[model samples]
Structure formats: structure tokens, C-alpha cells
Target chain A: MNSLDELTHELFTFFNGFSSWENSVIKTSELSVSEAHAIEILGTHGQMKMKTLAGHLGVTTGTTTVTVDRLEKKDYARRESVKEDRRIHLITLTQKGQQAFAEHHQYHSNLTEQILSVLSNEENEQLINLLKKINAEAF
Target chain B: MNSLDELTHELFTFFNGFSSWENSVIKTSELSVSEAHAIEILGTHGQMKMKTLAGHLGVTTGTTTVTVDRLEKKDYARRESVKEDRRIHLITLTQKGQQAFAEHHQYHSNLTEQILSVLSNEENEQLINLLKKINAEAF
Candidate 1:
């Protein structure tokens, strides 16, 4: 049996490596880390309410509001009020935001390819299966 | 063969789940995200200078200085001058900080156990070996 300590160390080491790679990738762009995260969520899931964005980002609505505000100011995103309920606002990425999202996603694909290159075909399938189980149930 | 796009989605979904779990865990504490990150590094690696901390965090020194300042204020860490090089200062975790590290690490172990329960013994070993390879080469 692999000790919990060994697995935990390796898990965190992997997380840290991914994090550092992400931070450096964001640094080369104009978007802040939080801003880039918001963009990713919005891009992946399409337009969503502020509350939903906050939930996805695991941040407070107030924090999401600030991030959305910055994105709007930078012309990367916009908040539109629903005609039926003016109080409810849905956030959408603008053309600029979509472009950034595509660029960022390409980088993610590149990284994924890099990771795939290091593993065997069977290992890649095993990894996907393992990650699927963990993602669906663990968290 | 798993397509790159499919693997990319699963990988990011897994990453997002882990990220959300971590943020929520941190939210229950007094430490900010950046501060908690710094403590994790200092606690794991022991004392280090400001530049080294920033490098590990993949952030700018200015940003690190601000984070270290907050840590110092909270008495979670301190900067000590080396006698041989008065200009150099190493950041060390205080007793309180060590206690916090232990607590946070326990949360991580709990999470790992939770994840382990969802997989078989063979799967667990496979996971460790796969993570080892990825951590060694993927990032």
C-alpha cells in the first residue's frame, strides 16, 4: 500500500507544478490571475449570472462583481440585464474576451499534449478514467 | 485513443474540482489565499529568502513582499537576517504557523483518504505511479 504521506506529497507537488505553469502563462498576458480564471469559467460555460460565476470561482459574489467590473472596463466582458427582471444580470464575454479564451485554451491544449507525450497510450486512458472517477465523486 | 480535447476537458475538470476544494478549505481560515500559499511553501521547505519565495510562488517580488508583510503582521512568519549576509533575510514560519500547516495538511490527508475510498488498491498504486511520472516530466 502506498502511504498516505507519499501520495499526498506527490499530489501537492503536481498541483504546485500546474499552478506555477498557469501563473507564468497568465503573466505573459494583460489579464490578472483572477481575471483569467473568470474568463476561463465564462468561456467554458458560456454566459452566467454573477452568483453562478461566483459559485464556479469559489469566491464571494462581491469579488466576482469586482472581477466582472474589471473585465467590462477592459472591454473583455459585459453584464446584461434580463428584460423580465432588471435586477438580474447575466455576464457575457465580448469579442475580445472570446479571443483571449481561445488563445488561453490553445495553451491548455498544448500543455495537455505535452503531458500526453510523457505517458503511454494505456496510461493515458487509465489517467482519464481515474480522473473521471475522482472528479465525479471525490470532490 | 483518447482525443486531446476529451483529455483536456477531463484534466481541467479535475483541476477545477481540486482548486475549488482548496479554496473552500482556505476560506474557513483567517489566512488569505496568498498568505496560506506562502505558509505552505515556508512550512514545507523551511526558511528561504524573499526572492526564493517569490520564485516558488511564481509571483513578483513586490507581490511577495506584500504577502510577507501580511504574514509578519499575523505573526505567522518572520524574516531573520543571516549573520554572514546582513542584506539577506530568510522567512521562517512561527510556532503558530507550524500548527496551521499541520492543520491544513490534515485536511489534505482527509481529502486524499476520501479520494482513496473511491478507488481500488490497484487503482491507487497506479495513481501514485502515474502522478510520479507526470510530476517528474509533464510540467
Candidate 2:
């Protein structure tokens, strides 16, 4: 295979392995992977408007609405009208949501440590830079 | 933030971007991402038993069965009873499935090209090696 082909194939395998592990971790929760991701984003960034949250998640407002509905029903999150603009709704994680987000973050930390252990400190830095470059310029 | 924390955060964003792009590409099809993935695996590896396919996809036999059933209905794949063992089913892509697989591979190729365009040849090689190391040793 060509260099590009080889790289792509290896990347695909790596992602597959990582995602399988993620699925197992998220299976422990009542939330789907996407739902848990919404919680994580809200927890990290604090309360935000529905549009902003949807933008970060790269999902449609409709899909985000459904997700927020489920979170609200589970008491993990709730939407409140913006004080200045009652027409706008902001979504915030509840205490339970914060707890779930913390657990998920810990799971990621453990996985990160395990993966980073395979590389030297320098290699980890290089990987981070490469990922940033890809994210910034590749899309 | 610490190196580990920064690395984890970047990786999460990278994956989220990639998956959103993948979802958009797969949304044009009748198949879900998992179902399309099953087609891709079968297309790449040629015909294989259902159990083997399930193992490769890191999904349960029941889940694999549902995906394969959808593929068959869509005329993207077929399950053939092994002549040696009537109870055993092997899954293979049909002609249309092969076409869809080719399209999906091309899509990945385009995305890979865009991502790799940001890196030098040497960096690409290093990245491939790093990914391989992670896959091998990161569990």
C-alpha cells in the first residue's frame, strides 16, 4: 500500500479499538454515547444556549432538543429561559449530570494514561501537535 | 493543563469532528453507521462467517445479525449457509454492496488525503508508526 493508504488503515484500526472501549464504558450508564457527550460538553463549558451546545456537538437543533429532553427527564439537565431574552433557552447540567460527567471524564483520563504510556514524553507531545494540526487544517 | 489532560481534550475534539463528518457521509445512505461498517468490513475481507464478522466489528452476534439483515434487505449483502455446515451463515457483499463499499472507501480516501496534506512525508511515516504503537500496546 501507499504511505497514505497505510496511514489511513492504521488510523482506522486505532479508532475502532478506541471506540469499542468507549462503547463498553458508556454501556455502564443509562446514556448513549452522544448523550454522555452532551453532558461532558455542558459540564466542561458551563451552561450555554441550545444553539451553542448544538454547534459544539455538531448536531442539528432538532436532535439536540431530543437529547436535552431525555437528559431533563432523567434529571441530568434542564433548560431555563435566558433572563434578558425569555424566548431563548439555556441548557445546564444538574448535580446528577455533573456526577455522570465526572465519571466519564475519569474514564477518559484512565484511557489517556494507558495510551500515553506506550509513547515517550516527547512522542506524546508530537502526537498532540499532529492531532491539533489535523483538526485545524484537515477538515 | 497537564500534558495528559491537554492530549485527552484534543483527542476528544478530533474524534468528535471526525465522527460528525462520518455521520454526514453515512446519512445519505439507508444504512446506519454500524450497518455501513459491517458492509465495509465484509467488502474488505471478502466473505466471512457471521461470528467472525461480529468479532471483527466488536459487536454481539445478535447485533451483527440485525445489521446483516438490514444489509440483505437493502441488497447490500447476503448471508449464505455454508455447504459444510448448514447452520453456519457466511456474509458477503452483493454487487450493489460492492459499489457502496467502493464509494465509502473513496470518501475515506478523500478525508485521509485532506488530513495527510497537512503533514510532511516524514511526519506521516512517524504518525503511522505512532498509531501502530498505540494500537499494539494501548489495549
lDDT of 2 at A62: 94
> Compared to the true structure, candidate 1 yields what TM-score?
0.93
lDDT of each: 0.92, 0.87
lDDT of 1 by residue, A12-69 (tens): 8888787778888999999999999999999999999999999888779999989999
lDDT of 2: 0.87
| Model 1 stretches with alpha carbons more than 4 Å out | none
Instruction: Label model 1 with its docking quality class.
Output: high
Candidate 2 deviant stretches above 4 angstroms? none
